[model samples]
Target: MKKKIIVAPLNWGLGHASRCVPIINALIKDNFTPIIASDGSSLEFLKQEFPYLETLHLPSYNIKYGKNLKKNLFLQLPTILRAIKEERKIIELFITKNSTVSGIISDNRFGVRSSIIPSIYITHQINILSGLTTFFTSRIHQNIIKKFDECWIPDNSNSEFSGKLSTSSRKLNQKFIGALSRFKREELEQSIAVLIILSGPEPNRTFLEEKLISAFKNDKRNVVFVLGKIEAVQKSWVINNCTFYNFLLSEELEHKINSSKVILCRSGYSSILDLAVLGKKVFFIPTKNQPEQEYLANYLEDTKLAPFSEVANFTSEKLKEVKFYKGLQVAKVEFDVALFSLFHSKRKL
Candidate 1:
């Protein structure tokens, strides 16, 4: 029997779920059965991505974000802690019920681990980007990360792709995975002038969609917009020169990315990894008031990797500057070796 590995990702957004696709595929290739666990849109996302796999529902952290995360996070801390504790119990029970399970991989889900099996924690943010509380938050997160047998930092060794986000100060059993992206780069024609991929938690997701639509609805360029609404019925319609989609699975979204000349998206780490894999130049508009996005946007710009703007400052005129910035053109798209190493020491519980 193939050793079963539980792959659990956070329910915050599709980024965590999406990045896990390549890892899940690698698991299957390495002859391991991957059981997915997640909640909310992320769960819906993986089900669509891998309909054949058995899935377990993990409770959502539901730490209300965006309406001021830095301010609201204080109010949600207790609930967040309780959620992590519950997640740990649920995973332990699952492992106990199925002694055949050999391992676990958690993508930022703090509690999805087991002492019985080899567990891996995957994250790019060694330096959690909370304003004022960054030092305290990073220390807390680092402690949780140390619980796993090994931690996987999904970036190059020097943390070139993620800047300071993945650079850990204290030593731990960490491996630098080249990069995690589901899409493969292909030699294709760039037919679309602009492709907008919007993601992250709600209110903000809807907010960006509305703002961009109002700004560019009249433009005659060949623009395509993906709403990132995984729950909504999949739909597409053309308005003026732009085509809008409710959501697109991996294959379809890859085609969209390869067909576009300039891509615009939130500077989420997963999105950055995907764009790097494709070796595409992009313009980013970080989600308003979100600290991580803001930090990534600035870091990418400061490093001359990509150009970004605040949501309010992003305009048709500002987009013209994207041509001047050099995206991660030098970053090699090599993911196999590091991914294969993920299974080097799998032990039966």
Candidate 2:
């Protein structure tokens, strides 16, 4: 019998859940039974995709940042540490109870996998955003990663794929897994439909949606907005040739993204991967006060693959001025040997 695998993703944002779609699809294609663990709207979205897979309600933590950077960090420090402890306990309990799980794959849930079992940590941000860290900080992050059997980063090896961000690291074991995208690449079609995905938590996501709606006030493109499978106030409105949807399913959503001319969305790692794999033209808008989004937005724009707009510069003029990549396909895609090598250890629990 094939070994069972559990795919656990951080619940703070839908990006973790969305990016895992490709991995889950690949696992299913390879005949591996994958049990998905998450909470909130992500759990509902997963259930919609794979209704038969086992599901677990895991706790999630989101670091809150206020307007004043210093005040936000001070307020969030205690809660952040407490959340880590809580997450660790939950992971330990799950492992103790589920003996059939042969492999554990995590998307940013720190220290959750079993010590004796084969586990892989998947993340794009190996470097913290504080930017004022000592060399010891990177070492500490590397040490935490060492606890896992493997580490996988979703990035292209080519210079055009990754821009400005330092891919350099002392850890030789890290692997570059070409972007795992949710959208499948398909033949080009002449269409005017546009799919806008709304993700992340709270005020920012909603705020971005409103900005997008306003930007399309006099535009000629069709638009549909997905509110990340959450239960929110719903309204149907049409502007010019655009239609907005609060949510959509796997096949329905994929169809829309495939047929669209341009994609306007967040610069989250998962979304970027999906766009890259599809070879679609994209416009990225990073959230305010979030350094990771800012980094991705800046990098994509600098690399010339996608244009980015910061929250402060979100306007119809900017969106209209953005250019999209039409004929670019990253041919050099490879999986991180460090990440999948854990399978060879024969470390069955």
Candidate 3:
């Protein structure tokens, strides 16, 4: 019988879950039964992607963000810690009931691992980039990561796309898995003049959507806007000069991306990798006051790979600037050999 593997990703935004698509697909091709575990939108997303696979909820972090960073973390930090504990319990219970499950792969979900089985933590941010708390936060994350048997970085060894974020100051069992993206470059016609993909947590998600829609609603150019909302069923509607989707699965999204002349979205790491893999030029507008997103946005621009703006300051005219930036950089799927080796190897812990 094939070994069963638990594939869990954090439900922060679609980034974690979306990147896991390639890994999950790899698991299937390697003859492992991948049981998708996540909560909220991430779960719904994977379910849509692999309806044939079994899925379970791992408890929602239900993380929300406001314009203020200090207040947001102070209030949500406790809740996040509690949720991590809760998810650990869920993972343990699930593994207990399914002894056949041989491994767990968690993408930015700290507590989704088991002591007995081979557990791997997937993240690009080994050094958290919050301005003042960068050290504290990075250390805290490293501790959580150390609990896992190995760390899988979704970047190349040079860390071109991820940069220092993917680099660890101190080494743990680590592998540079190259870029994990569920997309590839294609020569499709540009049916979408602009693709506005809005994601990240809570009111900010809605805020960006509203802001972009308000900006483009009266424009002559028709744009495709994808709102990464967590819902059981996918929905679509046309408003003004834009077509809006509640969410889109890989196949549909891939087409939309390939067909777009210009793309705009949160500078979320996963989206960055996705664009990088497709070699698509894009404009980034970080979610308000999210330091990580802001940092990533600036990092890409500083690297001359991409341009970003504050959502409040972004306008229709700004899309033109994307033509000047270099877009994202990518490496081949460098982790596949390493991933397959570990998947079949004896337990790391």
Score every model by TM-score. Answer: 0.95, 0.86, 0.95
Better of 2 and 3 by lDDT: 3
lDDT of each: 0.85, 0.68, 0.85
Q: List the residue pairs that clash in candidate 1.
A: none
Residue 305 error, candidate 2, Å: 1.9
Error of 3 at 19 (Å): 0.5
| Per-candidate alpha-carbon RMSD to the true structure | 1.9, 3.3, 1.8
| TM-score of decoy 1 | 0.95
**On residues 209-247, what C-alpha lDDT tens digit does candidate 2 reach at each position?**
787777776776566666664554444566666676667
**Clash count list over all predictions:** 0, 1, 0
Off by over 4 Å in 2: 66-74, 134-139, 158-166, 232-241, 324-328, 331-349
Give the better candidate number (2 or 3) by TM-score: 3
Model 1 CA deviation exceeding 4 Å by range: 330-349
